[model samples]
Target: MKTDNSNIDDLREVLHWIRNLVTGRLKIHFSQIDDYLVENIAFSEETTGLASFAITHQPTFIEFAVLALSYVPHIQPDFFNKIIAEYLPDGGDFPEFGCVKGTNHRGILPTGETAQFIIAGDDIGKRIAVQRLFSSEHWFAKEHVLWLEQVREGEPAMSGRMIMNPEIVELLTLGTVSKPSFSIDFPAEHIETEMDWDDLVLPETTFRQIQEIEQWIACNETLINDWGMKKRIKPGYRALFYGPPGTGKTLTAMLLGKQTGNEVFRIDLSRVISKYIGETEKNLARLFDKAENKNWILFFDEADALFGKRTDIRDAHDKYANQEVAYLLQRVENYNGLVILASNQRSNIDNAFSRRFQNIIPFPMPRPEERLSIWKKTIPQQLPLDMDLDIENIALRYELSGAAILNIIQYCSIQLLADTAPFLTAEMLDAAVRREYIKEGRIT
Candidate 1:
C-alpha cells in the first residue's frame, strides 16, 4: 500500500510539533510555548490521502494535534515515551502527561488527558476548551472520526483513552477505507448487484415509482444545497418498499445504488434487534455513527422486526420496545442519505415510520406480462428449450415472483446437467415449478 509522501510529511510535522510542545512545557520555556501556539501547522495541498482529509476538514491547530496524538500510537508506537524519556530519563510515571500502557502493547497510549496536557498544560481555561474536542457536538464525534472512550462509572470522562475510528485510521494510513464487513459491531452487509435496471422486471406502477427514487438520488443534493432548500427540506429521503417475499424489493434497492453510483448497505435485523434492554439502540447507534456522513444507501430488510407498530404499554419490556421504535424513527429521519425499509406488508410498519416516508412503493407479485418478460430475460441463450415447451403458457399459469422464476430455472439447469440432457423439456420445467409450489405450501 503506497501512501502519499505529502500525508507522511504532514503526520511527521504534527508529531514534531507535539514533541516541541511537550519539551517546552517540561522545560518551562513559556516563550517557546507561546510562539508555538501562534504558529499554525502547514499542510500540503495535494488531495489524495491524509493530507487531503486535514485540508478538507481544516481543523484548528489544537484539534489537529489531538487527532495526530490519537493516531501516533498506531504508527509510531514509542512517540510519547521518547518525549517523556528526554525529561524524566529514569522513566518514572508522569501523571501530568496522562497516558496509560496498553495490556498487549508495551508502548504508551495517549488518553484525553494527554491531549489536554500537550495542548493546555496547567492552564485551566485552555484545558476546559480542550474538552470540547471530545464532546458529542464536536464534528469529531458526530462524524465518527475521533473521540475519548467511555471510562468506568466513577472515573472522570477525560481519564478515558483517546480513540480514533478504525475506518479513519485505515483511510489515513492506506489512502482508502475498505468497505466494512458483516460483524457484531457492524450488523450490516454491503449489498450490490451486477444486473442492470433493464434486467429487473416490474409492473409499470412500481417501475415508475422506482424511477422516481432514482430521480431523488440524482437530484437530492441540488434541491438541498444548490437550490437553497436546506432549511425547508429534510436532508434525507426515506422510502418504504413493501411487498410479498421474492418480489424484487431487495433487487430494486440494490439497483438504485448501482444506477446512481452509491454504496448500499443492508442492515441485518437479526443482529440489530437484541433481547436486552438498550442493547438494540446501542447496536443501532454504532451503525448510524459509522454511517453518518458517508452518502451510502441504508436498506433495512425485513424491517418490521425492528420498526414494527408500537404495542400498548403493558409492561416494562413493551415500553422499551416502543422507545426503540421511537429512537429508530429519529435516526431514520435525521439520516442525510437514502434510507429504504423493506417489509412483507406495509401495515406491519409503525404509523410513525409510515408517515415519515417520502415514498411508499409496493412491489406486488408480477402480472402475467411482467412474468413473461422475466422468463424471456432469465433463460440462458445457450440452453435451448424443447419444441413442445410453451413458456408463455407456463408464465401465464404460474403466479410466481421474479425470484421464484430464477429458482425454477436453476433447478432445471441442474437437472439437465445431471441427466446429460441438451434441452430443457416441459417435464423438467413442470417438476421444478412443482418443487417451488411445494416449498410455498401451494398445491402443485
Candidate 2:
C-alpha cells in the first residue's frame, strides 16, 4: 500500500518521457531530479488505484509530501538517493544549508528549494511547491517545513502547492484543469444527534428547515457518495440558506455544523471574489477543491454578493456578472460537501440556479408568542428574575425579534449588575426595551 521509489520505476520512466518532451520546447531546464519526478510510477500508475487511498488516507498530497520530504532527510533509504541521483548525478549532494534560497545546489529553477523538489511526488505536492516558489520574498527552509506541516495535518495540497505567482507552478496546480469535474451520486446519510433544536431561539420554520436540511443531507447520501466518487473527491456537500437577516440564519448554520460534527468555514467573500474577469471563478474553484479535500463545510455568510441574480447585459460589466452567476451555478450544483449560502432577500437570488439547492430554509420573523418565549429564555435562570415580570405583555409591547430580545435581556442584566439589586426590575426592563428599539431601528 505504501510506495517509495523502489516500486515507481514505471512512474520514473513516465516522468522521464514527459519531462524530456516538455523541456525540449519550453526551455525550462529540468535536472534529473525533475526528470525523476515525471518518472515517479508510484503515484502515476498507482494514482488510479490509489485514487481512493490518496483521498481517504492522505487528504492533502502537498501536506503528505511536506511530511514525506521532511522525513526524507532523515530517511536512510535508497529511495531518496535514487530520486536525487536522477538529478544531481555528478556526486554533489543538495546543500542542506539552513536556508532554501541561498543554496549552492540548483535542484530547481533559480533556487534549490525543497518545495520544488517535493512536487515530484504528486499533483498535490506540485501545487504547494509552486505556491512557495513565488509567494515568498525569499524562500526559507522554514516555509518548506510549514508546507510539510500543512500536509501532515491533512490540509489540502492546492493551498500548499499553488505558488503566489500563478505563473511557474500554474500548470499542474491552481489554474483550472481541463478535466470536466465528475459528478458522483451517493445516498444521503441523515444521522441526527440528540440536539435540543428547541434550545436555539430561531424561528420554528427555520428550525424545521434545519431539520429538513439534515434529512436532505442524510437521504441524499447516495447522490453525495456518487458525486464524490465521480469527481474523485473524498466527501463534500453544498446547500443554500436564504432568509431575512436577524432570523438566526448564521446561528442555525453553526448549529448545523455542530450537528454534522464538521468544522464550518465561513467564507469572506471580499477575500474570495476577485475583480479580474474569470478570476473569481478560478478562486472559487480553488477554494471548493481545497474544502472538498479537507472536509470542511463552507459557509457563505453574505450569499447574495456571490450568488446574486444575473443582471441584464447593459455593458461588458453586465456580461461578466452573468458569467459569474453561471460559473457559480456550475460549482454549487456539483459541490458534494455541505455548502450553505445565507441571504436576506431570496428574490435577489437567480431562480434558475436556486432550484438546484436541495434544502432551502426560510427564516420568518417570530410571532408574539414566539417572542414571549424568546424573552423567557433570554433571561437566564441564574440571572436575578422578577417573577412578576409580565413577559407576555412585554413581548406584545416590544414586538421584538429574537435578536432584539437578547439585546434587551443583556441590557437588563448589565443594569441589574450595575445596581446593588440582585433582581431584574420593571424599570430596568423598560430601559432595555427603549435601548433595543433604538438599536434595532424599530422607531425609525
Candidate 3:
C-alpha cells in the first residue's frame, strides 16, 4: 500500500503532541494536563487522511487523544516505553502509566487505564468522565472506531487493552479501507459477480419483484432521512428469496449490490451456528457489529439453519434454539441496510420471521422459454455447434434451472476443449445433461 504523505505528517504532529503531554505530566504533575491537552489538540476542516476522520467526527480533545493513543502502538511500538524511560530513568515499573507488555511486541501497549491516566490523571471525577468515551453511547463504540477490549471477570474495565478497529487503522494509514477477509471473528465472505442484469433470466413476475428491491435500495435514504420518515418507518429493508438450489437467488443478491455500488457479504452459517449455549449469539453479534453502518447487503444463504421454525419448549436445548431465532430476527429487523434471507422453501423459515419481511420473493423454476434464453446467452458464439444439435429442442425437453444449464454448458465446453473437437455435438451435450441429472438424484 502506498503511504499518504499528508497522513504521515498528521500522525507525526500527533506523536509530537503525545510526547509533550507525557513529559509535561511527569514534570508538572496531573494538575496542568488539561491545559496541555487544550493547547495542543486542534482540528482543521481541510485536513486529509486520519485528520479528515477527526474533522468528520469532531471528536473531543480527550476522545481524540484516546484514539490517537490507541493508534500509537500500531505505528510507533516503542512510543510509551521511551516516554516512560525518560521520566523513570532507573527503568523500574511505572504503575501510574497504565500500560501492559504485548505477548509478541516487546513494547508497552496502552489500555483504557492509559487513556484515563493521560486525560484524567489523579482527578477521580475527570477519570470517571473519561470512562464514558468507551461506553456504548459514544460514537466511537457506535461506529466501531476503537474500543476497550474485554478483560477477564472481576478486572477493572479501565485495565482492559485498547483495540482500534483494523479497517479504521488501514484507512488512516493507507488512505483506503480494504475488504475484510473471512475468519472466525468475521464469518461473512465478500461476494460479488462480473455478470450484469442482462445475463439473468427470470419470470416477469419474479423480475418485477426484484426491481422493487432495487428501487428500495435506490430511494431508501431519501425516504427515511431526506423525507423525514425515519421516525415512522422501520430502519431497514428485509426480504426473503425462496427457491430451489439451482435457481438464481444468490446471483440476484450479487447483482443488487453490484448495481447499487454496495458490497454484498454471504454469512457462513457453518461457522456461525455453535453447539455451546450463548456462543451462537456471540458469534452473530460479532458479525453484525462489524457490519453495522457499513451499508452492506448481508445475504444469509441456507438461512433455515439459523432462522428455522422455532420449536415448542420441549427441553433446555429447544428453548435456547428458539432464543437464537428470536435474537437473529431482532438483528435482521434492526439492520439499516438490506437483509436478504435465502432458503430452498419459505416454509423452512420461522413464520414469525417471515411476517417481518418487507418482501417475500419466490424464485420458482424457470419456464422452458426462460431456460432457452439462458441456454442461448451462456453458450460462446465463437464455438461451432453441430448442425444437427438442436438447442431449442434440448431446452424444451429438459426441465433445468439457470444454474443447471450453466453447469451443462461448462461441462460441454471443457470436453470440446480437451478433445480439440471441431464442433460441439449432441452426444456431448446429452452426456453433460445426464451427469447433472445423476448429481441431482433424478432418474436419467
| Full candidate order by TM-score, most accurate first | 1, 3, 2
Report the lDDT tens digits of candidate 3 across residue range 86-185: 6677988777778987899999899988888877778899898889889999998888898888899999988989999998888777666888899998
Report lDDT per candidate.
0.87, 0.55, 0.87
**Regions of model 1 farther than 4 Å from truth:** 1-6, 29-39
Q: Which stretch of 10 consecutive residues in model 1 shows the poorest summed lDDT?
A: 29-38
Give each model a TM-score. Answer: 0.94, 0.59, 0.93
Query: Model 3 off-target regions past 4 Å?
Result: 30-47
Candidate 2 segments whose C-alpha is farther than 4 A from its true place: 1-196, 202-205, 222-238, 420-422
Q: How many residue pairs clash in each candidate?
A: 0, 50, 0
CA-only RMSD, every prediction: 2.2, 12.6, 2.4
Regarding TM-score, does 1 or 3 come out ahead? 1
